[model samples]
Target: MSSAWGNQVERWRAGINAWVTSETDTTATIRVEAVWQSVAWGYNVSNGVSAFCDCDGSDTPYVGTGGVYASKGETRTISMYTRDFTVPKTGNDRDVRCGAGVRLAGGYHDGTSRAYCSVRISHRTWYQPRRPASFAAKRSSDTSQSLTWAGDYTGLDGGYPWSGVYVDRGRDGATPSNLATLGWAATNYSDNSTEAGHRYDYRLYSYGPGGTSQATDTLTLYTTPIACALLEAYKPTATTVGLRATGAPAYVDSWEFQASTDGGATWADAAFDEDWVCADPPKGTVRFRVRALKSSGGSSPVTLHGAWAESNDVATLCAPLAPNVSAPGVVATGTAVTVTWQDNHPDGTAQSAAQVEVTAANGTVTTADVKGAATSWTRAASQQASAGTIRFRVRTKGDHADWGEWSSYAVVRVAVAPRAAITSPAASQVLDALPLAVAWEVTDATGVSQQSLSIADASGAVVWSATPGKGVRSLSVGTEAGFTNKSSYTLTYSMRAGSGLTLTKTVAFSTDWAQPVTPTVTPTVGDGYTLEILIEAAQTEPAAVSFDVVRVNPDGSKTTLVSGLKGGQTAYDSLPPLNVAYSYEIHAYAASGAVLNYVMPYLLDSDGHEVLSFGSAAQEHLALRYDAQGSESGKASGETFHFALGTGQDPLPAFYADGDIDVTGSHSYVIADADEYRAARRKLRAHADGWFRDAWGNVAVVAYSYQISYDAKQYMQWQLQLDVTETMWEEPNRG
Candidate 1:
């Protein structure tokens, strides 16, 4: 049957039966059920199975099946060879079969009829769970931890399975000494491990569907505490102290202060206890130290030794000391007191205090403190004993030491007593007028402190007094009748005790006083036609006088010519005045130098004109004859001219001429012959009228045509004839 089936499968394979399905006890089978039968040959089963499934004979499997079959479904049990399923297996066909079975059953099948199939499958993915990130820590007394995390799960199968994170501290991979766990979905966490040091480690992990991933690289952390120390200290002396401290690692919130006077064995709270420190501590001295304390309980202290000193302790000793005194010296009136001393420090040190002692001649002694090195002591008046000698001296001292030796002695002399006396205007004399002069003298037993003189008139009134320092004194008695007409006055003189002595005296005196008088003068005419006068008397005593002149005119006019004359008399001259008659009045003087009376007026002129008179005189004949000779004949012979004249006067001649004739002869006769002649006359009868006169009023000797020629040379021969006579002449009227 196998041979026959094989022949038929081969025929079927060559014919149409190529697809088939079958089941068996240990394998499922598939075959081509239809065959191509020919009429020449009966139907033949051929092409035995094109595709087949094989179970490893676990349960149902088909040994053989042929021809066509209807819808046969198969269930089978197969044993998979683990060796055949191994990756990278040897033997290609066997490996292909194993891989194809797994793929076909697992629902990854391609539409192909094949006896074997094979495939390769793998996965590349990341397993990162939510873990902590940005870990940080803060400084705390207690141990603590803080952290944050990020989450990412991609390219992972079955999504991200349950995941978590944990923190542990350890150097090695041993069990974690300290561990902290965080569940999945947790991105941040904080843990207080109460740990602090320079070295600490932490670990982070990731978990997914596959397994837990390797832990991340370990991280280390460190922490430190705050520090503080001293920064500065100031100590001027054992008692004065100051301190300052600095906070290290951080800032300080406050400060503490304490002080100790007995070394460090005991301490007391300082007056300046405060938190905030200033640059300058309070003034004055005290032991002090300070500690800077931070908010973190950190502190630093600065203790200063020998910090303060007393305020009044002298830094340098160079000031001067007070002065001292030596033995006292004797004192007397007008005696110099000598004081001698030395400075405590001989190098001319300035003294703060000094003093001296004085012993008087009267056995009295006293002490006087000197403000500075130099001092003075004066003698008392009582020390001048019985007009003898007195002496004194001085002493001195200074800051560093006392001075030796007293100053040289000084002495003064006492004088005899004095007595008061009056000197002038004689006492108890006659009556007088005002302004009387009084004088006096004063004396005492000892030196006088003061002296004076007082004058009282008859009316019992004190007129004046000579006080001290004014050596001479005088008084103006009042003009009242009782005082001015006083019969006598009393003068008192006194002296005061200057060196312990005094004296007083009184005396009588009188006055012959008189007042000044007015002055007068006599009028006179002086040189230069001036109307002047001389002062004859003064109207006041001692003849202090002046004079003035006034010209008096006939028409009641007056003018001042001179004034301000001295010497009790004056001479004035050349007084200017209008034309008038004037007179003089003479003044008389009394014994008191006053003007007593004036003389009666003496008239100088009555009509105010100066007059003159001529005496006896007679007239005479004067003749002139014209003698022509040679070519000229006589024109007239012995011409006679007559005129009335007076003594010392000559008669002027008158002559007639028919034609021009030289009058040189005529002028000569008039000049030589006329004595009282007022003037000469010349008459001429000519065809042309002409006349002329000469310097002496004589007619010119030449007469030209229609004019007279009186040339000086032609008149040089003029003479006049005088007649002796006398006549009364009156003064000419002033025009």
Candidate 2:
């Protein structure tokens, strides 16, 4: 049995308890006990012994001493007599206790061995139970009352359910106590019940294995409402009485009307009405205010006041009367009078029914209703039968009460007849020619009715007269034929009054007349080819004078050449022997007027030219004073001529013997021949000294002439010389 035990022991570790027993030595029973420490695991033991041995049936090994031996000890090594064993555990419990009070029974025999063993063992458990962590709560917003909680038991592998968060209302006390059983979701709490003027309190809680925590410091909160709107005012009338407030919501219940007369200082309550009647008031100037009463009992004052206005009760008066006499008086001749007044009113309709009154002199009173549309009045002519001073007064009717006082009196006078007098050509003696104008002045007690005036010449012939209508009278007059020359004349005037009266006046005047004298001329010769004469006549009757040209030679031969001459002046021409001496004469006839006669003669050379000729000549039977100067003489010889440039005598020679000698200068000389001198004189009949030019330049000749020579040769030579010297030298200095 021990041998068989040894073979089974080879399959396990040596330190393990192994046992074997033999019932017949061919079959065996083996037993072993293994032990390990509390912290070790995975034990195994094995023995190197084969259960199939070669001996069979007849072979028997020797048994050990003492029937069966066993050995057990701690081993550092495993041997063939011991076996190793295994247990399925890991980590710190891998070691196993073996053979400490352990018991085993097993056997292996070759027909004779047995073995038994005992072991004791113990092991420690390697796990502990987990505990929960501290409780914590997470709060989102205090005002929102939202919170969450987390701990060690949360999301555990194998533990109890997690705790929930809790919140308290604090001073607000609005938290729901039932909320502890339910988790604190954000929507779970509602504390928003406090008013806008106040504040509230709040707290947060977390529940774990322990009870709920205390509430946090009180957190307070508050709320408020929304905003309001505006209002306006208006005025509709000119009187400023009907003022209104508007611009309000439709639900407004009532309105309050207030007024301010003195620029909004003290306001008076006008009215409070739901119908808005206070908006439309009476007349006058005023300011207004209003308040709106809303249906919700809310009231707002007027934000604006309407503009000011006026009323329609005041009236205006008429303007003062302009200063003038409208109606002087109502009276006949030598009678008493009455008067009226006038003015302009501003209001045309209000003055339509106005009235006026008047008072006269002698304390007498008279009243006349204003007739038609006229504003002035006057007494009737029958009422003013006697002439004198009169007074007046005025007033208006209807709503106007004032009456105008009495006015100052006006004075006037009357007479029986108008006064008459002459108004033109005054009352005195004075000379007047034909066509004399006559006039008169006529004024009367009534007025001038018929005014008349007349004029007559010295022969008592009525020349002109006039009877004018109402004012002055005038007419023109003329002298009568056969009246004496230079005699006095008379004019008379008359006037009749309008109220049946008469007056007459007369005045005298004188006039004169003198006739004009007739004139005659003489013939003369000059340096030109022919001899001619010009005669000018002065006559009161110029139509009556007659003129003729008669040629009288130096031999006393006479011939009547030109006749039937008319006009105030006449000229005659005749042929004379050229460059030879000749004498000529001119005769004039007045027929019915006074006559004047002048005779002149001249000397001509062989060229049929006069030797001497006067510039201008007038014959006088009497001697006259002479004033002379500057190279002037009365004689001429050969080529040298004596004459004056400016009243001075000197001899000047001719440039040529003869051929139309041109003379021009300022000089005065006389011709000895009466007829020739007079003919030369007539050339300047009306004009005084002036400029004369003849194809040369200009010469000045004085107006008067005297005659001295009659022989044609001597006169011709003298004229030629005079023309060359005086007329030539005195010519204008034309450089």
Candidate 3:
């Protein structure tokens, strides 16, 4: 039992014997007998059956019901019927081989794993006798004809001797009636019964043991004189032509000879005799043809009648019409231009094509082709000779001869839109005058129907606006109250033409009003009770001031004697008059950093008085820029001062450093309003924000650190630097 064969499956082939019982075009019914010889013990039952190409149209599956048993040495048969089988029949389509198959229809559980045997009905088939090839009839004379053919006659049905060869005759156009029967061995026949002007058709067939073959190839013939036509056509001149042919002109009772101009589009006819000639032809290439007419009331000419002969084609030429042309008044770049024309040459000729002549403003003349005889043409603006004043002219040429005269130039200017530029007040300019004058220029425009310039203030109010007249090339605007010091303004300029042309531009500019200048300081050190320092105001009134008079003891620690005082000539009478190496600093600030800060004053009194010469600790500097836009005074347990900036700054790509190329920046200035703050912001915005932008603008966070103290002396003092870190950059009024 351990041997491999013990577990192996012995599959058996279920035997099927099938044959077709009845068949329709699409379906067939088959009778089947399924018998199983028990190759394995007790494996002999099949219930139902199905088969292919038999009666049933589908393939057979296992049958589980009907039982067939063939006990050792005895045979049992199970008969089953299947219907709806596809017969696949058409013409000679035959189920001649082992075509029908059967199988158990369903749910059969016999030990047999395969079909044991399959039997298909078989039979021998035979073919018909071979028919002769090329069996044809030809005229032997004006009144007689002969028929001939060739093929193997003794090779059909395993060499079945022929019984006889049958021949038939009929008027060429009528049904053939049976004629005499010839000896089985003959393949040719002669007849003296054909007419001179008649046609004839012939066919040959053969038969043997097998059914007759589909009729043999057929042959057709004509015994008429005109069927042997020989026609020819010739042109003697551009307007004259002649035709000639030979056959039995005597039998060609009537003939048709046609002439074509324009490659057969139309035809002109004449009697097809020897003297045929066509007079004065119209416009086109000439081609000719002739056909032999059939005898009036008799029969068809022939099976394959004579056709038109080989001939030459002639083109009738004439003068072409000079094109009458016109063009549009306006043209644009990359747009199509339409030019129309009419061709009218008295000699009857077509307009071959229109020649376009173009002239540019620079006097460059160029030409183009508008091909075809159409009444109109379209050319893209891109295909125009030039983008300038492109003038056009037209002419035409035909197959006949000459190119017609070019028409007068139809002028059209290539349209281009106006280009705008700010000739004055360059971008981001800081003007000092209250009424900023903005000037702009427009070139390449035909005219300006409406041109206006407007400037908007911090609150977005249009403080100034004006419209320029037509034909205006440039405009300058200086409006009252149009500009505000320490504030930024947006200027927009736009223009419109009657031809629907448009151009627009916008730019930013601001003005600086309070420019701090250095005050004239005259310091006279005096021994009196008050230090007389004569301080004259700078170009503008100095905003605030502070000074320091220090005494350095032997160590580096210094002592303050007279400090934190207001600007003017501060006569500090509270001086300790420290005689120990004393030094001092005088400082001042402009109201805001939008403009320059005034210089510090020197101490002076009575007349040129000095104390140990003079030692200065530091120079004058301006206060940092700060704005009170969203700032308010509030009360907490005591009091609180809260301020905000921007709505907060929008993110920027990068921050700009002090002197970058196209990025212009002014480092020395006071910052007050949004205008001044924005100017300074632009200087560093490109560089600072990129590091990490917080709610407060990086520029504001760094610039507004120079805080002011109200103490008299410190009020005038300016803190030049404030240490900053990433965390300190928060919204200005963040709780």
Candidate 4:
């Protein structure tokens, strides 16, 4: 859309200026200004003009749809609209041209048919500041550094305003880490976080609204280290020396010292102790120097040794005599090691003072001074945490300024920690009875002096304690001890050595006194012709018991009819043989398979028929056959013998004889019929050497015989003989 011309075909001149104002990935904005005069080609005037751009090096106008226009013969500028066009994103620099031409109403007019013009486009660039030059760094103090650089806004891009300068700092040629943006006028900065004697690298960058300039060359610098002032060394004795210094700079952590025995020709590291005796300096003149340092680095040594060289020769006071030293051979971590020594002054002079040096396992040496009258010194246990051999040596001074030579070192071992463990009554074990048996063992280098064992209930009260003594590692407690059933306990055993080192161990256990009780059994006949025995009140101490009902068979054998019955079980039915008497016994047990109770010999007759009989209690009765005769008798017998003696006066030398007595019994019965006779015969043969109780409640075994006179006889005579051993109703084979 452009302005229209009045009745004339507007002709454009080639005097146009075009430049790229802004650019993007695919297109650029070009502003155009032109000076033109309208010339009429014919009386047919064009209505308006349109602007266009050619980007492909071809002079042809690519877009000519709309543009701004100027009125005829008037110096006036009007807005113009251009038709849309596309540019290929081929390169960063593009040759773009913008201009206007006549537009016809029917179609686009060729450039040759009318006058058209365009100008080569130029891109615009903004201004940026230049890099700062002459960069430098300097140390201000031990902990701070100052940076200075000469900089200006010269060589700025199109005179654009700059923001500030950026200083980047790093260490040991590393990439820049710290960045500081300062005002344009600021040419220096003070870094307060610098470490003493540490190296730092710095560079400068200048930036503006346009962009940042290239970085300057890096400058490396190191912070200053503190220097020690007034270093001095003195000899306290012929065998020892001392060094002292003061005046350390701020931020200095500690000082390091070096020694030179040959006039500073060669130096060796020396510990920075106030008194150099522990360093073991040589007897001759010694030179010393000192320096100050932080954790980062150390400063140069301050060599002021001219005032510290010792003038007295080391051999003037006579070389030291060996002292007699004695110390413990072994010790525990928290036990002290006592060392004693005798002053061996050759001249018999009274001793004034003494010094003892102790060397730890890690090669650290320490010293202590004592009066001459003191013969022994104790090394504190707190300083013996490390476990290894430690060494001790002593030197004495007898009214002299020089200390004698140290004695041979006495070696003592700091033993590994003593350990003791409970080996019996394992953890979480359950005990059935009292008087717990406790056992333990210990491994230690130092022999035990005293040992104590104590048992405590779950409430932490000591219920029982063993007799306190040494050399016994185990003890037993019985029911007489103060212990409660159905309770948990902890056993603690402690062993102490003569050196006052103690070791302790503990184990936990519980006591369970719950046991089975003899159940009251009630027997009755059931539907299957069996005995139904009910456990009327089979109770247990803690309610976890099992019951077993076993039948003792006639032929010295046992049969378990029922077993593993818990507390909730009540009754068990047992099938038995017919026509023979039987007895039953009940046993109760705990969950741990321990038999708790056993009650025996509950007798009953089978189905109201019997071939034998046993004694009964006051209200109890046994079934008996009709018209039986029985007899009982006793026999006593003995043997006597004599042997001649060699002595004439002795008539009878020896007589070996003993009297014996046994009770015998017999019974006779008549079997009514053949069937009864066969049954009785079978019963007698089955129980012929088996155990049973006689009518008088004595345990006996019987042999029987029966005689039938003829096959048609209706009755048979049965005869039985019993050999009774004891009056007690018990089976010898019963377990």
Candidate number with greatest lDDT: 4
Give lDDT tens digits, candidate 3, residues 457-476: 77889988777675554544
Q: What is the C-alpha lDDT of each candidate?
A: 0.38, 0.37, 0.48, 0.57
Over 4 Å off, model 3: 1-146, 149-163, 167-186, 189-203, 206-305, 309-318, 321-735
Candidate 4 clashing pairs?
8-45, 8-46, 66-81, 67-80, 68-80, 127-157, 128-157, 320-405, 435-477
**Clashes per model (N, Cα, C within 3 A):** 103, 129, 47, 9
Residues 1-735, model 2: lDDT tens digits = 122122122323222344332212122333332221111112232222221111112232221121222334332322112333333222222223222111123333112112333322212222221222222222222233222233333322222223454544433245433333445222244543333212234444544433454443434332211111222223322212333333332332345566655556666777634444343342233455654443211011222212222112222222222212244433344443344444333222233333444455576666666534455554555555554445555543322243333334444332243555555456554433334556666665567666666566667776665566675456554432222335555666666565444567777765443333445454455333334565666555523356555556545765555665554454533234333344444444444322223345554332211212222221111111112112333333236454456555445643335444433232333344455455554544433333322211112333333333335566442221122233322321211
Q: What's model 4's overall lDDT?
A: 0.57
The candidate that achieves the highest TM-score relative to the unseen native structure: 4
User: Candidate 4's residue-wise lDDT over 56-88, tens digit each?
Assistant: 343645234443334444444333333333434
Model 2 lDDT, residue 48, Cα: 20
Model 1 lDDT-worst window of ten: 611-620
lDDT of 2 at 637: 27
The lDDT ranking, best first, is: 4, 3, 1, 2
Better of 3 and 4 by TM-score: 4
Tell me the alpha-carbon RMSD of every candidate: 44.6, 41.2, 28.8, 30.7
lDDT of candidate 1 over 1-735, digit per residue (tens): 000011222112212122213322222222222122221222322223222333222222222223322122322222211111122222111211111111111111212222222232222223344333444332233265454546444423333343666667663234445376666677655556544222345666656654665665565433332333443445433223334445432333444555544444455655442532333333322345544343211111222121121111111113233233332322333433344444433223355565455554465666677676454444445445455544444445444344433544444445455555656555565544333445566544445577676667777788766575634434433332224332477777776656544567777766454533444555564322333456655444554444334444334544344444454455443222223335433323223323322332334421222111111110111122112111112244345576666666766776665553322222222232232222223322211222222222112112222112233565433333212112122222211
Number of residue pairs clashing in candidate 3, backbone atoms closer than 3 angstroms, sequence gap of 3 or more or interchain: 47
